[model samples]
Target: MLWLAFHFRALSLEVFSRGAAAPAPLVVVEKQGSRTWVIACNDAAEACGVHVGMAASAAQALADGLVVRRRDPSAERESLAGLAVWAGRFTPSVSLAPPDGLLLEISTCLSLHRGLGKLLKQARSGVTEMGYAATMACAPSSHGAWLLAKAEIEKAIREPARLGSLLAALPVALLDQPPAVVEGLERVGARTLGECLRLPRAGVARRFGQALIDELDRALGRVPETRAFFEPPASFERALELPAPVQAAEALLFAARRLLPELEGFLSLRQAGVQELELACRHERRDPTIVKLGFVKPTRDAGRMQLLLRETLGRTRLPAPVHTIVLRAPLVLPLSASSGDLFQARNGEADGDLLLERLRIRLGKDAVHGIESAADHRPERAWRPCQEQNHAAAAANRHRPLWLLPQPLPCHDGRLQLKSGPERIESGWWDGGDVARDYYVAEDRNGAQLWVYCDRVSGEWFVHGVFA
Candidate 1:
């Protein structure tokens, strides 16, 4: 089996920088005893001579305008787990490697992505799109891949025979052993893995304990590796807290874009489409403002959804500064297959549906509605307004006018010429409003077609609608 490992070098710093409005030196510091030390630093901080493990005060003294934030381990863990869930799009077998890494078993899925190169490219692109920097490596053994990724050695080793020699030259620190064991190896002139392996196995195991030997064996593919794979959630709902409050709704789009690909991946894995989505913006001291988006049909296209969301945000007014944003998809359905015609430029039904959705977004939901058949027999009560066209109901076997007048008008005596006709309708007696009419298709003085019906009880002729 082939294993792929991804190591997020500065996960905390990356997560912090994503919410920043401008590029500046930043470091994530953790309280160590009475002193604060840098656990992660961004590229700007590193360029300014601020490195990890340095005192926060010393780093601030070295660089001007340095931003130091307290390290949030919970947020880092959540981000890593979310990435692992998103990795399910590539393969079903994915496992988290604690604080800053992910392991994926991709041997079965390599062929589906055409080859290892394409698969690696797609994986790297996806990680970059999510606003994280990752170093990736692949090897036959899971531990071997993990070690390579942690060492920043980006190479693929498929041959089992090549694994031992490839990993031998790496530093002894790459092994999953305690710091004391690594120091002991370094003191014994075994700074490299090759040197450590050359020592007597019995003495090394006795000195460093058997766990270190087992880890080395696993790395060399001599021992079987076992790990629990991550399972994706049934529904998609993710939230991100901004580094600073955003006062405008338009500014929230940049932060929201970070989550769109994850949603696309979730939909792709399930082979489903979303019909509706909700974006909840959490304020500091007020109730969350919810922006709901409804689609004319189920869709999984991320670009289309983002465009519609852009239009929606343009017209939205923020009640308060947004500190956090949550994305939720409450309704998802199985995607249906559609085939296009060769003669037409585009599908008329699809274009119409998209247009209707755009109009609904620009105007309002209540302003746009379609017509559908009703159960009543009265000409005025035969149809009702609906948010969506009921195609099934429209297929009923009945003849009706294209345009119905709001109120019936009396027909002139000599202006009518009957064409076809005498369809009798008698109903609506339950509500004390009974209708007895004989409807017919007729022509007036001109060549215009009209739908005129006669009241049988009163013998009064009325023009109800026009065909055109």
Candidate 2:
């Protein structure tokens, strides 16, 4: 069935603002152990003036007793991601709605997981053990359960038809109405959903607009709802949490070994390769770190990447031990195919290309350059510098060497051995300095294939480019 996703942002943000849920005198700290206390009474916590958005310092000043610590967003996100991964075991369709929220399709999974009650308990325990409290609801519709889970008077409402009545007593706030509409409804003594439902639809629509009716319609299962679940990519990048915080480079490389195979599998599934990727880690008592690598061309060979990364890992020293890791690549391309004639063709030469690209990332863009054709007859002006784009296209043009020296070198004297010539070209006459050159192919003394041309009027020879 559908599930209600509850995000206790107020509670999480308290931990984000401070390390723990600090104790307030008016708040009931149910003793779990000698030093372990759970915030048992939420009302008492609120009664002690521990409201959301109220600064920890302010709460302490107001209550004279409070606990606090630095917030850890990375740890929180990691925990959420881990929970999302675990939830996948129940349903393939899992939506991580962020900051302590999850939307799972339990319709198909309900029977598999032993009904709604058992699944809810499992989810609750899963999150609870991960260090977060969750109130769950499963209904025929997602919105209906979401309302139940978020209600102040919390209880599971199993029967679908009985859901409307359960929501009838809920506050207007639960309807997701604008603050002004809630205020207006409160003024009119319409404190419940049932009371608002009793009002004329036309009047409500005219006064509060369609937002009120829309949310109600969603709650009642009159509208269609869909969740966009994150799809697993063909080639994946993953970082593992260290068993303990790690500082030595070898330790980080060892952890990456566990993820490399999975990444390779993901690439194989997509029939693609990992030409570019990154590895990130969070060190002990330090911020998270990132190490990105790329290839000259697309490749799926985990062994190659593993070796390269191992080398990099060995070279780099950590300032502090690492606690977690993250790997990512903004783009991934297909592997190149090579031809039988090694020197003449580059049907499959992705590895070299990807390697060079990785070097460019480590170095800078200008560090690498390729030759591109220019529409000009002058030998030097015929070719221009360009960066690699379509790997396939670049491979196909491998028979054509890219580096044509910036300026054309002067060719042999007077009588030129022009293989092919007189492809006449003339331009820029009206603007200022005009050109009149006849392009040609010629053989040099060293027997190198050179793109040469002759100045029609001046009768000068210049070597423009090289042919493979």
Candidate 3:
């Protein structure tokens, strides 16, 4: 099993948000209840002889400045999910370690990311970018790295032998013992793992129960740690460096043209379509220009992507001549087979694969997009547009239309009659914004059919979707 060590990047700020007033200093106080308690206090809060975990009344008796909020279990969970998404850049096999930590299985990704040391730095960097600090450790087992990260375990990691020595220096606390077992061990003067290891194995197990011993075995690489792995999403990305700084859109797209084929090849191999892709064009003297492309569904076809890119690029201007270009496919999805004539049909469509390359040459890679379903289920959120080369499969889905109105428009009268449907779609409520919409297909007296919806609770009418 690939081991990962995770920590709460910052629990205090994330758990408790403060308003912009010169208020008292806030502190998180853990209590003996089923829930974790957060107490907001100041110098007066500190003077109450009250500390975190003290009884609420005790805290109030000490200082009147106490704002209490029950700990948000949901917030912690959401934080873990965000961490998992950020960690996806390192490895797809990311698991949530409750409270505030991520357990990523990076064994298979080590080689691809340059090695364990680089991978660790990369993981740390990924978390750091999200407005927090994090450290990562990798070992043969989860408990080993879990303890290492908690203890801020650092080693040169030049060789596996050095890693062993670092493990040996660890304290018994790193073993994650229960309160009673730890107290008993401390009473007996066993502070470090070395001391504990020197003791008789049978005696240690008998005294602490087999669980601690089993954990030790795993940490020492004796027993095995079994865990399920996550499958990486399918995606394709291409990058190119310009021969010379070129401000002309055509010149920039020329480099993109060459990179499209490789991206298509990667997508074809994965049997996936690009859901979304980002383009970064680096300038020698100015900030790199960034653009995004999206598709309606999963697609591997390159020609349609080319069309979209050409159209999008035609409207953009290069701020400066570019030196290098980068293409990133941050989202990808499974490719579905198209329902059509299986064999060579009477009319063969323009090879999407070839067209994407040519378009890259003309529009620059940053200008293309394919659309894919967003993870959310809201009518407006059900799909996300992505770069064409990346979400190739979604680009190939011919069912979706080309033009999209920013938001569905309200009908004349601001009140729409439910002509066809009360198709209620309810989704994404548990996580954050819950949607309950009663959908309908109505038409103006002029015979212009419109797709509309009304809020189930609010009874507010809105044009939600449309069919052309």
lDDT per residue, candidate 3, 165-201, as tens digits?
A: 6777787775667889877776787887767777899
Pick out the ten consecutive residues of candidate 2 with the lowest summed lDDT.
14-23
lDDT of 1 by residue, 321-427 (tens): 99888989999877645522111115576566667878999989999988887888887888888878435546633345778899999986657888888989999
Ranking by lDDT: 1, 2, 3
Q: Best by TM-score, which number?
A: 1
Error of 3 at 148 (Å): 0.6
In candidate 3, how many Å is residue 205 off? 1.2
Query: What's the C-alpha lDDT at position 133 in model 1?
Result: 87
List candidate 3 stretches off by more than 4 Å: 12-29, 33-68, 156-160, 230-468
Each prediction's TM-score versus the true structure: 0.83, 0.44, 0.46
- Model 2: per-residue Cα lDDT over 355-457, one tens digit each: 5655665566578866666676444565566766552242334323355666777875544456765577787686576878777776666677667767788
Q: Lowest summed lDDT over 10 consecutive residues: which window, candidate 3?
A: 339-348
